[model samples]
Target: MKIKRSAATIIGEVSALILTFLTHWVVFYFIIINSFKTRAEAARLSLAFPKKWQIIENYSYILSYGDGLFFRSMWNSIRLTIISIVILVLVASMTGYIMQRRQGKFSKISNKLILAGLIVPPSVISTYWILSQLGVVGTLAGLTLVEVATMFPFSVMIYKGYMATIPRDIDAAAIIDGCSASRLYFQIIFPILKPITATIVILRSVVVYNDFANPLYYMSGARNSTIQLFVYTFQSAFLTQWNYLFAAIVLISLPPFILYLILNKRILEGVTAGAVKG
Candidate 1:
């Protein structure tokens, strides 16, 4: 059956798109335009296009700043994002699979804990203290672990929801063929989970890559900085160079934006599938 949309519904949808454009696209345009301005001109922070473009100079300065600290920070952010995503995918997927397949006291307790994780805001002080005790504070490994922990609960929920949609009969069949539990999951179930995995990867990759607060809290020092933290180098008490700051922002924002553009469809599909299935 086909349904006809009301005029009001069409108008509402169009209005939402216009609003989104004004809020997001307009802001992006403002940032891009300002990034090309002189330090004094950028300080004005107006939507007007730059009268004098310092395109190459601004970007080059940002790239070559602090003996190429920006590049090092970029590498650090990338490494953290990749490591976190890999661990989250493997651990969360298996945990979700087990939680879905097994129903018992342990599963119940775990579900409650995950629920709590979603609701509870983690204490930065406590987390830092714990990391300090573990002797991992200010290290990439510690930061990676924190990133994975932060993302784990939601990832597991998505995996568990999607896992429920997969028939248990498949597991029975695989087992009947002498597939071990680990083999069945890795070879069969894991491959089938690519869609959700892609969704998780793109979404979480952006979060981890763009994360400023966690990195600031857990990982200190210039050498340990992530791309987001590299922005601080542009500011000081005496003066702030808005042009260089905006330019750096533009450069750092590109990777995640490009990634989203490439895999945007998977995000909606995965979320919707998990929602409907679970």
Candidate 2:
């Protein structure tokens, strides 16, 4: 009876997993299917093969010749993601270290502030206040600042958790060896933080890369659009020409997609290490 029950449970779990895989396959299949056609095919034969099979033409049209602003969006997204994620990782590392190591009233308050920032949606009060003050409405710098502020808490929490597992003895030893705080971290603790750092890097990059609302609010011009914002406009505008839109999507999605694909192993390792150690 116990053996039968165990088998039943295993079968149920397998069935659920299979269902999830099928769903994912269907979604990706449609996305790929749309990328190889013109607007006519996308509208008329969404589920069928392309009329001309002009995958290159579809791709190039969006990129170079088509009525699309894909390349500009691609550049904007890449630049914003790289800059924002790098700053978040570095600043969050230092802030996380201090928050954990200091252990004072102020540190506790600061930690709570970060958590509050995370808990409250950025769209609520902060946007109103920031826009009212900094006059950063619809500017790249404003958007970058907001992104950093909103994303910092997650990185800090991850870093702090990972740092907790690291021995204070290491810090003491480094300090006794005449290592300054900056040198100690940059040399000793920083190296050990590789896994969580990679995890944060990939995670934050993905978030910033995929962001739409923030860009929509803060970025306007076709010349100044990020990938997500650009894709959004194209989707809204092109009711008929979906092939070019899909191709634009495919291009815009390549960077973060490629970055995660290449760094996936490191990202997993970092997350696993942080989890187990924390």
Candidate 3:
């Protein structure tokens, strides 16, 4: 039997789509339009095209500003992201696999703690104090640790939920075939986890890359800054230079945007597969 769609449902769907389009259009329009305008024109924050386009000048100035500080910040962001993701993937995968496979009081308690981490916010002052005691308070390494720790709980939950779907027969079979626990997980089980892993990688990478609050709190004293920090500093220094600021925003946004475009299909597949399996 064919079910007919109601008029209200159709209207609601259309309204939702229009709202979504307008939201994205307004944001991109502001960024792209202002990016091409002169400082005075951009200051107006107008939706119109620039009377005198200064694309080249604006971009050039941003790139060369403060001895190429933008590029430095970009590199810092890349480094921090890479380190954080690598550690997160390795640690979370292992922890999740263990938590899912091992049935005991310990696992139950650990699960509760991990869930609590999701609900609770970290104390910035306490974290700062710990880092200071470790003598890495103002260093990139310290910030990397903070990022990995912050992201670990969510990543582990994703992996653990996905691991629940895998049959215990696989583990028993691998063990009977003389595979050690480490070898079994790394060689056999990890391969099966590719879909969920891809989801974690894409989602967590975006979060860590675009993170502003963690870096702001933990890395304020660092000599080199992350891309977001650089933007904040640039805004303060060039308070009236809206054109340059917008240009910088566009450039900084390109890397993650390009990454998402390239891997969007995989991201969707991974997320859906994880959700269904979990």
Candidate topping TM-score = 1
Question: What alpha-carbon RMSD in Å does predicted model 2 have with respect to the real structure?
Answer: 3.1
Clashing pairs in 1: none
Clashes of each: 0, 2, 0
lDDT of 3: 0.87
The candidate, 2 or 3, that scores higher on lDDT is: 3
Instruction: Give the RMSD in angstroms, all C-alphas superposed, for model 3.
Output: 1.9
| Candidates' C-alpha lDDT | 0.92, 0.80, 0.87
Q: Which number leads on lDDT? A: 1
lDDT of 2 by residue, 36-66 (tens): 8777778764567776787988877767642
lDDT of 3 by residue, 160-278 (tens): 88888889999999999999989999999999988778788788888888999888887864356888877776566447677887888999889888877877777766666656555
Clashing pairs in 2: 61-66, 195-270
Instruction: Give the TM-score of each candidate.
Output: 0.95, 0.89, 0.94
Off by over 4 Å in 2: 1-5, 44-46, 65-68, 124-132, 237-240
Task: Pull out the clashing pairs in model 3.
Answer: none
Worst 10 residues of 1 by lDDT: 269-278
